[model samples]
Every structure is written in structure tokens, then in C-alpha cells.
Target: MSYISRLGSAFSKSSMFASEFFLDLYMYAHYCGISPFQDRRNKTYYKLIIETHAIEKGLSLANPRMLFGRKKITEIMKAARRYGIGSNDLPILMATGALQDYLALHRSAGLSDPLLDSIDAFLKDRATASAVLGSGGLRHYPDGMPSPSPEKAALLTSRFSCRMFSPEPLDAETVKEIVRIAQTAPSQCNRQATKIHFYSNRERIGQLLALQAGSAGFAETVTGLVVVAFDLAAWGGAQQRNQGYVDASLFAMNLMLAAHAMGAASCPLNLAVPHSTERQIKIVGEIPKDQRLVMMIALGRPADGPLKSAASPRRTIDEILTIRDQAVAAA
Candidate 1:
């Protein structure tokens, strides 16, 4: 090619690349939750999730401050009242339960405060009233950790996304074991950013699954829901921005395999929503803001009787494999 022609082509390519980059920035600004364009409902819902999680985290602390998170409880009440969030909503219900647990814990210790009265009033208010759906606040683990199960060779090929599940919930021991196996998945620099939030409450599971798009027909049958996420704090620099997803995906695959090995069925649900929706999920799931969601896994004991699943045909080995041999051919 002529020198002038080459120069012109290079310039055109650079201009196109710059334009595309700016377009990406524009889209991100318009849609990201941090931007002003975020939906009002999502913002209100996100606030509730964050406040409730704060209470939960405080309760989980080994040495919690006396009467801590009073402001957070107030914020939760305000958001719930403003948005009309009811007990039927998992996030609100969890917030109420966490507050109740907080009050009970403090009262038992013979500590009394006006903030407790405020929390009590908030709980009794009809506008924000919600039954504390299931056990919330702090999760109590069994005394000892369960040992990991032996690896089954057939699990890889035999396992598929299970759509139908029995009414039985997954046992806590088995769930812990599955997570123990999944924790073995490789991570970037061994940061171990991946975290799983398991939900076994049928009503809460239904509420969570409702936010997901792919669980339409079989959501009712799902007895366990697992939200797989990776901590953003584990990654730094522009090059590592997307690394969280890669690591979390690896962890999620391992988790599914582990479930299958444990004789439980699991189906992965996609979380390809806007930034606003993601924020809402993080809040509702009681996940930390530093974590980014990868996907959700609906799991449980397989239903009895014959079951059907997608064929999910695969490409041929020849189509997928590409053994480049340019050096050999040149030689």
C-alpha cells in the first residue's frame, strides 16, 4: 500500500476506536446505578437492602457496639414507609427481623435505650408491618464442619441444570459441604473473592427468584436459591475490572458440580440486568456492596418420577479444536 493510503487508514481506525470508547462511557453513565438516571424504585429498594444488611452485619460481629445502627434502623423504616415495602418483600421482612433480633439481644443484656423504643414502634407500625418470614438476623452454624464428599467421575457429564425439584429443602450440612467443595475453585492470586448466599426459605426463595428472568415455569419447585457473587475489593486496576466475574464463574461451576456430586440438582439462573437491578439484588440478598453478582443457582433434591431436560447439543470436536501449525508448515 502507498504511504499516504496507509497513514489515512490508520487515522480512520484510531478515530473509530475513540468514538466506540466514548460511546461505551456514555452508555455506562446513562444506565449505571450511581448515575442520576437510575430508577426511583430501584434506589428506594436498594436503600432498604443496604440498611437491613448493615443490621445483619452488626449482629454478626464478635464484639458489637451497644445500640449500634440506630440510624440505619431509622433509615430502613423511612425507606419502607416511603416506598410502601411490606413484609411480603424479603428485604423488608429481613430488616424487621434483624431489628427485632437486635432489640431482643439488647434487652436480654439489661440494656435499655430510646432507640430500642423507636425500633419497637417501627416494627409495630401497620404501614411497615411484616411477619419475620423465617429465621433471619444471624445464622448459627453447627458445631463442626462436614467433610467434603468423594469426587464422582460421572458428575461432570451427568449433571445438567435441574428445573424441577422435590419439596424437600437441602440439608444445612449438605449445603455447607457443597460450598466447601466450591471453595476449591481457583481464584485470581488466591484472593478467594467468590461468596455464596444460600436461601432455603420457600417464600424468600420465591421473592428472589421473581427478580430473575429465567426461572419462569419451575421457580415454584425450587427449594434452595444460591446467589453467587465475587468481591470487587479483590480486584484493582482497569485490567482486573472483569476478573471478578471470571473467578466467580469458576466458583459457580464448581458449586453446581459439587451439588450434583452430593445428589442434589441445580440450575443456574442468569443475572444480566442493569446496574440498578444489580444494586437492588445486592441489597435484597443482603450482600455487601463490595461484591458483584455472577449468577443465581436454583437447587434442591430432584423430584421423583421421570423428568425431562434440555438436550443442549454440543459442537463437534473438529469444530471446537484448532491446532495451529504455522511454524510446522513453514519448516
Candidate 2:
């Protein structure tokens, strides 16, 4: 390539970077929580999401906290009313039913809290609860792996994103073994940039989870937390700008599967945060600034005996996969 042609290419790439930088600035200014220009409807939608998450987490935790659900149930109902309840309200309704079950069980044992009465009264007249509770609600099933089959497909389908974990702490060597398996994940140019920060200390895990509010109730039960990250310094140039995230994510998936295979229940927590929150997490976790975080995985054994989990349905393969050969020919 000619020197002038290379210069022109460089200039074009710089211009593209400038444009993307401005676009990112615009998004950060208007779409994030601190943005004054954020849409009010979006705020309401997020509030509903927060309440829904609290409800789901409360029910899915190994130790059910009726009081925790009690604290958010009213807010959930209010938000549901404001947002115009729909099928999305099903999880909230199901959580409320689970809380009711706990309350009933407590009463049968000659134990009751004042809050339980108010909770019962509120649910008695709740239109949203009446709408979905009986027809479609969360159901608990017996816990055990599928009947022995040598089929690989059966094993793949058996994996679940477990929220509740047993109290026993995971040993460091066991965690290292999982990472050893995850190390086989493909990386760009054999860079092997993926890194994990393991936190087994109860207090440290609590601090990390507090920074990530989504895992509020279940954080206490987590035996360990792993922060998946990749070194951006290993990348060469513009073409490799997003390779870190891609590689780190692949490693994370492998790590989860490996943990599951080793009798560990793992839940991937979102780390897609604003710059400020990301910085705070780095400081608290003592992670190097150059390491870009992909996500956090909560790891531990599932609770012993019968337990419940979210039956989050998946989309059909036809809905997700597409064949573009015909489109290419038409073009």
C-alpha cells in the first residue's frame, strides 16, 4: 500500500472513532440513570423492573424471606397498576403466591407476624393476583437430575441458572479446576487475555453483590463470586477493539458449564454498568483498571433436598436462527 493511501485510511479510521465517541457521549448523557433528559416512561419501566426482580429473587433464594417480599409487594402492586398489568405481571403474582404459602405454613405452626396479616389483606382484593394466580403461577417440582441417559443432548438441556445455593463454601482448588477447564475457550491470536477474580470471603462477596443490586437476596447464600475480565492491552488495534469482550464472554460460558458439571450451581450476573459504577466496582474488588469486566458468576452447590427455580422459557430455534443465502442471492 502507498504511504498516502495508508495515511488516508488512518484518517478515515480516526474520523470514525470521533463519530462513535460523540454517539457514546450522547447515550451516556440521555439514557443512563443520572441523565436528567431520561424519559419518564423509561424511569417507570425500570422501577417496575426493580420491583419484579426483588419479588423473583425473594422466591428463588434458598431461604425464603417472607419479610423481604413483604417490603416490596406493595410497591410491586402499585407499579403494576401504574404500568397497566399484563402477562409480565405473572412472575410478581407467582412470587406473591409463594409468599402466601410461607405465611400459611407459618400460621399452621402457630406462628404469625403482623405484616403477614396486612399482606394477606392486600392480596385478598388484588386484581392482578386474582387474574393470574390460579390459572398460571410458579410451580415447585421435585429436585433431581433427569433419569440416567448417556445422551449428550440431555445433559446440555439439564443445565439451569441456579439462584439458590447451599451454605457450604467452595474450595479454592475446586474453583481452580473449573478455571482449568474454562482455559480451553478459544481466544484471539492465542492472547489468552481472560482473567477471573475469585472472592470467597462472605463479607467481600456481600460488598460486591451490594454494588450490583440485582443479586440482593441471594448474595448471602453464594459460596463464591468470580469476576470475569480480559486485558485490553493484549489487543492490537481498531479491529480488536471488541475482541476482549467477546473472548471474556466465551470464557465465562465455559466456566459456568464447567462449574455445573462439577456439581456447582452458577448464575451469571450482569456487569454492564455505567463508567462510574464500573470504577467503583474496581476499587472495591481491587481489580486492575486495564482489565475490562465481562460479567460476574455466583458459584456454589444447589440447596439440598427439594428446591424451586425459575422456569424461564426459551425461544424456539426457528425464531433465533436465520438462513441468509436466499437474501444474498436476491441482492
> Best candidate per lDDT, number?
1
Candidate 1 has a TM-score of: 0.54
lDDT of 1 by residue, 117-200 (tens): 877787777343544342346553232112234455666866766565778888999999999998999987899988899999
Given candidate 1, what's the lDDT at residue 29?
92
RMSD of 1: 17.8
lDDT of each: 0.75, 0.71
How do the residues 1-331 of candidate 2 rate in per-residue lDDT, one tens digit apiece?
Answer: 9999999999998887777767768988888865778876567656655555555555556666546666576675566556554444444444445445555645776767777776566556554435655211123547642232468665456666678788987888899999999898999787899989999989989888888776876777888999998887898655557789999999999898788677777899999788888888899899999988889999987777766665443334675689766555554
* Per-prediction TM-score to the true structure, in the order listed: 0.54, 0.69
In candidate 2, residue 168 scores what lDDT?
86
Best by TM-score: 2
In candidate 1, clashing pairs total: 0
Tell me the TM-score of model 2.
Answer: 0.69
